[model samples]
Structure formats: structure tokens, C-alpha cells
Target chain A: MSLYIKYPKYLTAGESCVVVEFADEIDRGANDAVMNLKKYLLTQKDISIVECLPTYRSLAVYFDPTVVSADEVINAAKSAPELDGEECASSFTEISIPVCYGGEYGPDIANVAEHAGISEEDVIKRHSSKSCHCYMIGFMPGFAYLGGMDESIATPRLTNPRTVINGGSVGIAGKQTGIYPIDSPGGWQLIGRTPLRLFTPEASRPTLIEAGYEVRFVPVAEEEYKKIEAEVAAGTYKPLITEAK
Target chain B: MELIIRKAGMLTSVQDLGRWGYQSSGVPVAGAMDLPALRIGNVMLGNPEGAAALEVTLLGPEIEVKGTGAAVFAGADLGFSVNGKAVGSWRSVVLKDGDVITFKGPRGKGCRGNLCFAGGVYIPPVMNSCSTYIRAKIGGVEGRALKIGDVIKIGEPAALWKKLEGFCLPEDLDPAQDANAPLAIITGLQEDAFTEEGKKLLFESEYTITAESDRMGCRLEGAKIEHTEKGADIVSDAIPLGAVQIPGHGMPIIMLADRQTTGGYTKIGVLTPLSMEALVQKMPGSKVRFRRADVSEGVAEQMRIKEAVRRAKELRLSHVSRTHSEAPKPLFGHFILTVEGKRYEITCEEI
Candidate 1:
């Protein structure tokens, strides 16, 4: 068992905002500290905290300094309750997203496969096998930073980011994988595309997934992918859901 | 009860106090950049503080009133004419059906125009705010800028025959040349990250708002600010209102009403609330200078302003009650009244 150590470092983010750093660098443990603290602080019913946005290694706490002072926040953080060990042990959920790899759906899949010295089939199988954790949300609305990937599949970011990565396009960069919720600029190495509507403004919950959700990928034929896209456009596509423990 | 934009200006959109409480989902707090002026305009019309108003940039479009109405225009003098006849600003004026309202080029640069109808502008509130957010493509009228052929409905006036004389801002109280006004700032969390020289330069230098500025942030171009040492690629953290974040390049970016919830950068200072509202209204290329103020002074000033606003509201209420029963016939009773010791004169018409 890895013993939890309080990562040292605190920096003022803005005039009133404070960031409590959990580690000197990014890692799954650091990510856990942020998530755990976020969950803990959010449960404080009376605290007028504005927001708690978690990142790879820290949870940025925003509050109305007028209502609650920065010193109070620091005190609360130092004595924050310990996280339940079981919560961390809950394996990332198994979510299968049907992806059309290669060709128009995934123009960069073959390139990624070649770069990893693996066959196209091996890339798809390795990618779909393990569930990934939703570390945080940023860069764009509903765009999740997911962790957990077979080390063999890791690759460097592109020299030049694409001017536009369509919504629902799944890509990998370094040790991370993510899905584009909206069409925006990106630099991730695209390996495949999902037909899921990751973000839909008309939906009650616009973002298809949230931080802490698990994700899985499943290979599909191009024709099936096109059909799914059509359903999404028609507002008839329903994400395959599994009850999480 | 309705108005149509016969001619769309450079940019016209519906706004309110702001879309608060929804920053977590990455929603921008889009609202009138000139909030004080917006509030005063609403108060003049006896409308609620959160009433939707129209914010016209630089030049206002020609508007055709479709129904009987009266409205108050506030903020910078956007050159105004009714049927080609020049009129005074900061006062209520009756509009006849088919009356043409046009705003020529602004009298001066860095001026925005606000039109508050006797009745609030009727637009569906998205996420509890009428403010327009162009980026997220949500809120306001279809979550977009006002365009030609858009028919804006108006609600019933809160008070008929109400005069708008005393509530308008007197000429002198208006910031003399608001656009170029030096913004007073309070040092922020990352001020210590920069070298003493960099810190000195921040207050001494003049920065120009770049054309790239928007509701998200106002990017400044000036001497590059440098830190005492190289900084690490920081994990994202919460950002506060008016926080000035300087990334690696040294260009200071002042966050505005629609800024993101979190960011990663070395912050140098934060604009005081009073100055932030004024600075955000400035157009691109407007000159900017920063001055330092301590946090205690900043907080005290905010409290003073808040008390002043409260007093203004109470005085307006008292004036309303005083005029309602014991009455007057001055075509309008226009006099600045004192609230919380700050004075605000108003004009009221009792039929």
C-alpha cells in the first residue's frame, strides 16, 4: 500500500483565489489527492466556495473572499478529512464507445499504429481493453482528460495541433487520451473517432460524460459508425449506460 | 410593447446584471460591461436591477418603436438623434409609434450606449440570465447578437407617467474620458513571482488594449513583464474577478466578466471592482495605466460604494413614496436626492 503524503506547496492563483498543490508533478496519486479533496470540500454545506476545479495535481479553490477569507480556506484544507480508501479502489467503469478507426473516421490511426510498432488490429484491441478514469474537465466544455492506457500505446503530441478537431473525435497524446466535445483546436494524436455526441447543447445535460466517469472503446464498421452519427443528429442516440457501484 | 431593429449597429445585444451561479459548467458571465450605468438606467425606469437592457457598441442602430413607449439612454454619449433632431441624454423621452431612433458615430471613442425601456426588454432567460454568450452559443436572443428583422418584445412599464430627470448622471460625475482612465489595481497572488523591476514596470508603464480583447480577457501590449525566476508549468487554479494573469510572454491579460473559472499563470495584480467595470467598457487601442492600491483600501472602497448604491436606492424609494400621495406638478420634479449620504436627483411626473 502506498502511504499518502501531503504534497507541499500553495500558491495564490488570483487576488483572492488559492491553489493547493498536491504534488510537485502529475501522477495518478496526485490526481487522486485532488479528486478526494474536491469531493470533501464540496460536501461542506455552509462554505460559500464558488468552485472546485481539479487538475492533474491540484484542486483550484475559488470562493468569494468577502464571504470566506483565504486563511479560513487554508485552515480547512490542512485539516481536511481523509478520503475513503474504497472510493479509490473502485475500478474505472467499463464503457464501450463504438469507434470507426482509420480512413475518414480516424485519419491518424494508421500513423499512430506505425509509430507504436504495432499492427492496426493490435492498437484497437489494446485500446479497448482497459477502462480509463476521467481525471478532470478543461480545454473545452465537456472535454475530459482521461487516464489509464497501455504504456505501449503512448506517443508524443503532434508538432502542430490541428486547427479543428471535430466533437466526438477520440485521440491520444503522451500518456493521456481524451474525446473532443466541441470542434476546436487540438494537438492530440488522433487514433480513432467515436460516433457519440460528446456535447449536445439541446440536451438537459450537455456534456455526455463528467469527471469520475469511466470510458471504454469498441471497434465498429464505417457503415455502423455512419448510422450512429445519423441517430445522434436526429437526437435519437442514447449512450449505452451501465450502473456503477 | 415591441421594437424592431430597423438597422443593426456594429454590435447590439441584450444584457442584464450578469449570468452568475453557472460558472462551474464553463459558462461565461456575460453581461453589460458597464454595469453601473446599466443599473442606473434600470433604476431610472423603476425597473428591477436585473431587468434586461440593450447594450449598443460604438454606434447604435436605427430603431423603430412599434408601440407607445418611453425609454432612458445612459452611458457614453453615442451621438443620438430622433428623426434627425438631436436630443439630450440621461433623461427619459417618450417614443411614438414609427419614431426613428438612430445613433450616429459615438461622440468620442471608448463610449458604449445603454437603452433601458420603461418596461424591461423581454427576452427568454437562459440559465437564469439574459446576458448573451456568443462563444457557448447560448443565452440572450437565440444566444446571438441582435440582427436585422429581430422583433424585441417589451414588458409593461413598471410606472406610467414616471419622469426620468434626477436619476441621470450629471455631466461632471461621469468619468472624464472613461476610456483612457488609469485603472487602480490591488496586487494579486502571483505578484511576488515577478522581479521587483517587473513589478515597478507594471505600475509605471502604459499598456494598450489590443484588438484581440473580448468579454473573456483584455490582452495588453507593452513591455514584457518578467519573473525573478523561471516558473513551472502550473496546474490550473481558480481565477478571480479582475485578476491580471501574465503568462510566459509577459503580456498581461486582465480577466473580465466572461472569464473562465480557472487558469494557469503568474498573476501580477487585480483591478479594483470600481475600475474593472469601467475598464472593461473601453474599446480596443484604448490606453491603460495601472496604479497599485492595498487590499484594505480596495475592500473599504468597495464597502463605501456598496453603501452608496444602497443609499441611492433608498432615496429613490423615498422620493417615489413622497411624490405618490402628497404630490407635485412640475412636468417633473427633478432633484438629486441623498441616500446613505451620496446624492442622486430624480425627475418624477405625477399625472
Candidate 2:
């Protein structure tokens, strides 16, 4: 349960940015290290730091060259203390997302089931049974790249991507599964749709899920989905969140 | 001051330096494609370098002014005119109320142009920027491109506006017009992920800008870049503004202002800011060649461009002072004056 990895490589992204890469592959330990370093850097409040973008196994730090040089940023990143395994273990928030599966909400449910050689009910059960950690948020704003999907349910992305996928649609692609936070063209096999607003510029936080958070899907009936949708539209729906043990 | 969009061209939107300090939350830093152009337009009007301006793409918009103000058109030379009469670009022109400003097909090589008023556009800032990210529906006028009949407000002009009128940067200082200019790139990141042949192909061959190019990215179709064992995919990582990412299909995509915050494609290198400035100006079908430049060289080139912009601004200010010896009487106890290309604050009583 201890997710701790050492980042040994740092490369210059450009004249103004530096990328600290943890590992080449996407693993829990690498993601944990990336998230921990990002948290550490933000706390330092370095005047040179303009923005820091954390991904699966790396963090791209954009800085003002006028304020700090690339060598100085790399040196700061190298000297930063690594998080202990225990600290990484407990720093996660578990949020249950209500998803309406099959029929109209999930057009690709049958496709996913056929690919996985399982029934529609089996697909839903497998998807909701396990919790996943957000590795990073990218592609579109608030779109979390999640880890920890059941291998049996893994399905390849659509050969021809749809022109427009609605926001809050839950999708599965290969070993990865995530939700589209905004309406965009995508190739993921969507198995369900979530009623919660994953991204909204009006909100103070803007994005519902951040990197390193834990996510769980809770299958809801059509009536429940409609009720939650209405509440979300009216700004009264509060998402269920609790600290992960 | 106000202006109504009589004919909204292909795409018109308000932009500034960009929306910064929010990329950590997956927000893209969307801004004008040509940063230098945006700055030059603002500088011509005596406005701040980061002031909001209209980014007119391809065919420019037809606008009718409702209040008197000064305006400057910089970057692309899309046949700009005042009521069908041709107007020179890169110079300040005083507008009269009800004057109709319009533009025809591009007369130059660039794809986008920046039109800035004496006072900046007055749209409320979103995430501390007025730049529009149309894909996400954030910033600018209702987070979308300007349509016909959309009226935009302009901020109050500077006290030195009368003197600053007709100010123009020397013709030699204009942005270079080279459709086939080589873009300087700094190799790093996933450069090793590509095959030696791939790297050679990128530098040796000329790529044509396809019609699929947009604010998000400039997708080029040329000699396919072959990847090594990595095969063009990597653990998703944050993308810099001018990252040259090669997808599985082998075509290189130069990420731009509205690019996603992160991507999984293997990026061979990143273009220098100056190179990106020049690259963005090229329209579809324009040919581009890449040249590897040392990091120090790229940085020095950018510094040189910045200095050029600074010098041009100084020249404009000097022209204003030389042409107008008598400064206007102080208005509202404030005497604003420009000296040595710097704005000075002096009370009317002190003056």
C-alpha cells in the first residue's frame, strides 16, 4: 500500500520551463512522487515559479526566466525532500460519483460488454466494485486520467472518435477509465454518464477532482439520475466525499 | 468609446498576453497567437503591453465606430480600410464617430492580425485575463467568438492621445515577411524517443501547414517522423506552448496557445518564442523548415526581438514629442507625459 518512487531525471521543456520526470511508465508509485513534489513546490511559494503542471509521472514547471534560470529550477527540484511512504498512503479523498449506465446514458455499454466477453450487468458490477486513483487531469480542463480499472473490463478505444462527447460521460479505454469533464471529441468507449458537474468556471475550485484523489462510481437509477441532475443544475447538489482509509 | 461588429469575419475574439497561473488545474494559457503583434498593437496606442485587443483571423471584421478613438492594426496585413479607403498599418489612426472600419482578403502572408484601440477593450477579465479560450467557453465576450451585431466597449484613452495620433514605427522595424523562414527549435524532452532518421527528417525536410491547423495546434503533414522503441507514445506529460509532438500517425503537431495542458504524444522539441511568433503568422499551405538551435542561442534571439520592440516603442514616443512641442493643458489635476520612452506622473500644480 506504500506508493513511493524516486524521481531521478529532469529535462528542460523549453527556455522557460523544466520537466521533472519520475519514471517512463504509468505506475502508482511514480504518480505519488509527482503529486508529492507538486505539493512540496507549491508550499515553497517560489517567486520564480509561474505554474506547475503534474501529469502521470512527471511535473512540468513553468517559470519566469527573468526571475529564475533553468539551472536554479532544476537545482531546487533536485534538493526538494521526498514524501515518506506513510504520507502518500493517507493523503487521498474518496468521492462517489453517481453514474447512469446503459440505455441512453451509455451507448457504448453493449460494445464494452461484448469486447470484455461479459454481460451488461457484469460490466456495471465490475466497474463500480473497485476504486481508482486520479493519476492526472489533462486533455480538457478537469478531465482526470484515472488508474486502477479492472483488467477484465478493459476495452480498446473507438477506431473512429465521435465528433462530440457530452460532458460528464464516463468512458473506458484499454486499461484506463475516466470521465469527460467537458464536451469534446474523443475515442473512449463510454459505458455510463455522471450527473455531477465535473468542471465549471463559475466554481471557486473549478475542477471537482484533482490529481491523487480516489474516485468510485455508484450506479444510480434513471429517477435518481434525473433528481441529481436537477439539483446540480440548481446548484444545490453536494457531492459525497470522505477521506480514504 | 464603442464599436459594433458589422461583419464578423472567419473568427474574431479578444485576446491579451494570456490566462496564466491556472495551468496547474488543467486550464490552458490561451492568448493571441502572435505575442509580439499583440504587444506592438498596444504599444502603438500608448497602452500597456498586455492590454486586450481584437485577434482578427483570415478575413478581418468590419466594425463601425460609435465614439472617437485612436486605433492601430498590427501583424497581418489583411487589406485594412476606413470606409473603402485603404489605410496604412503599423500606425495610429484617429477614428471619428460612425466611421466604418473594414478589412478584405489577406494582402500579406500572415493568417491573423491584431487591432488595438487607444484604450484597451473593456471586457471583464476571467482568471485575470480577457483572452478568449473559445473551446472551454471562458473569458472574452461571453467566452465565444464575436458575431455580427456584437458591440464592444473601449477604455478611456491616455492624456497624451492627441500627440500620439499618427505615430508609426519605422518600416524597417516591421515583422519580417518570409513565408519559408526556418523556425529555430531547442531539442530536449522526447528527442531521443525519435529515431535518428526522424530527427534528420524534421530538420532537413520542409513541412506544409495543413488546413487542420488552429489555435490549439499546428498540424503539419510532411516526411513522417519514425519513433524508436517508444513508438511515439509516452506517459502523458505537460505540454509547453511550442512543443513539437509526433503522434502515432508520425505527423508533427506544434502545440499552440489553446493547446491542452497535458498530452501523451512524444514531443521531439520545442520552438523558441520568437520562432513560434513567426510560425503562427503563416497561413495554411505555407512552407516551414526547422533548424536546431542551442538553448543559449534561442534565448539570445528572443532577447534581441524584445529589445527591438522596446526600441520601436521609444521611436514612436520620440516622434510624438518632436511633432508636438506644446503639451495639452493638464486635465483633472493630472499631467501625463512621456520622457525617454517612459511614462512620468506629475501633478498639474508641479508642472
List each candidate's DockQ score.
Answer: 0.27, 0.62
Of all native A–B interface contacts, model 1 reproduces a fraction of 0.20
Q: lDDT tens digits, residues B1-351, model 2?
A: 899999999999999989887776688999999887788778777788889999999899999999888888888778778888777578778888999999877876677878888889999988788999998899999999999999999998765565566687777667654556699889999898888988999999999999999999999999998999868778788899999999988998999999989888999889988888888988888889999976676566556666667876787566544532386643433457999999998632212
- Candidate 2 residues lying further than 4 Å off, grouped into runs, are A1-7, A113-119, A158-164, B171-180, B308-351
TM-score of 2: 0.90
| Candidate 2 residue lDDT tens string, A136-199 | 8887778888889888999999999999999999999998899999898999999999999998
B1-351 in candidate 1: lDDT tens per residue? 698988889888899977665444545567887776677667657777668988888878888889777777767778766777666456666777888888867776456767888788988787678888777677778888899998999888864324443444445434323555678878756676788888888889999999998777999999888887757235565566788889988889998867776566867767776787678667788888988876655555455444544554555555444443454433454568899999885755556
Model 2, residue B201: distance off in Å is 2.9
What are the per-residue Cα lDDT tens digits for candidate 1 across A1-245?
33235453565543345677776455676677777787788888677787677766677677656677766777777677766667676644445678887777677777779888999888888888887877666656577777888878887888989998887788889888878777878888888888887765445665676666677788899899999989987879877867565
Clashing pairs in 2: none
Which parts of model 1 have CA positions greater than 4 angstroms off? A1-20, A49-51, A60-79, A91-96, A156-164, A185-187, A223-227, A230-237, A241-245, B80-90, B159-166, B169-182, B315-351
Considering summed lDDT, which 10 consecutive residues are worst modelled in model 2 chain A?
A: A1-10
Total clashing pairs for each candidate = 7, 0
